[model samples]
Target: MGALPDGVYHIKLDDQQFLTIGEEGAVTVLPAQDVGQKFEVRRASGDNYAISKPSSIWPSPFVCYDGAPAAPYEGTRVRLRVSDFPPCEWKITAGSRPGTFTIVVAGDGQPLTIGIAPIPIFPPFLQLTSSSGKDLGWTFEEAK
Candidate 1:
């Protein structure tokens, strides 16, 4: 796929895990659930799309880099931010695997990668990492 058509979707990390809003609003990879799995994929001009909570009553927080939009160097943490910062945008492009796409930061141009939490209690979280040698494929299934 080139770019995802604007819509709601269940963003899968793999066969079993999906991108979800975890405790304290941190984005994490976990099994799909009724809540927090669905994200609104909206075109943010050009090839960029903004990912947000599909049904939030409050203003949707866009999934973005933890800090100001800049070059997403290795190990930059990913999180939800209330502001509609330009860096909050992402470029969804075809991945190495069929039916999957890679989410790259619109401003920094680095693919979002999974990072293991330092504490075992916490689940795996998303971060910006080097594009080389990283398994950054994500499957976006249209939400019902």
Candidate 2:
């Protein structure tokens, strides 16, 4: 797998759940939809990309790890942030499965994986976890 072409996309996990923007900008996984679920992926440098919600209100924010790089570990959630700091970028790379990719934090190199929500009622969310698991694969479908 190579770097994804710059464009808008619907990021899916294992072809089942789509990466969605939940209330207050939390990133969660759920069934696919046509609106408010798309991400604008722009190549910042090399394999690094800035993933953001184009449909968001003014001063659009991009997804990034929620903790400091020095302390990153499993369960570090990804959230939409309104900053241009280094942590706001991600290293999108080839994943364990074909036709999929793993999104890694640019600052600490931790791969984003599927994680259970703290509250059972909420859907699964994306979090920084060990790359040793089978949950790091994600598919990028160009949004039409």
Candidate 3:
């Protein structure tokens, strides 16, 4: 109702579709016609977006990649890990809410780098973790 913050926001697109945006300016299209339709917001740039469907509609849990269902206590922790080359990257299309999580990658491979916009422009928690479920010691703090 009031002025929206400077970040990505999700809006219902019809009764079966949704659109997600990213701070880097990407747009993702989601076609969810059923009540349990699940999708993931990866990244967004300009007017385009990227997304992934990890599960079928209904009671099944949804995740970006094949893995165990996230524990309830994990809260908004989006886990990502890479062991090979190709330079893996994850983008968060959801807007900058205080508790909203972007992407968290960790592993024992190449060092990962996180990037985000300057403060007052973007606010999101970017983290990296290890393959053993440990923090990979990387954080992308918003620049002042």
Q: Candidate 2 lDDT, tens digit per residue, 48-116?
A: 788888744656677876764455667877878765443466778888877878787765444554444
Give candidate 1 regions above 4 Å deviation. 56-58, 84-87, 108-121
Q: How do the residues 23-137 of candidate 3 rate in per-residue lDDT, one tens digit apiece?
A: 3322233453333223343333432223333334433222222231322212122223222221233433232444333333233343322222122422232222222323222
lDDT of 1 by residue, 15-129 (tens): 6788898877788888878888888899997877888887555656778777656556667777777753334777788887888787777764445544434446558777776
Off by over 4 Å in 3: 1-54, 57-97, 110-144
Number of clashing residue pairs, candidate 1: 0
Any runs in candidate 2 off by more than 4 Å, and if so which?
Answer: 55-58, 68-71, 84-87, 108-121
What is the overall TM-score of model 1 with all chains considered together? 0.84
Quote the positional error of residue 102 for candidate 3 in Å.
3.6
lDDT of each: 0.74, 0.74, 0.29
Query: Which one is best on TM-score?
Result: 1
- What are the RMSDs of all candidates, in order? 2.5, 2.8, 15.9
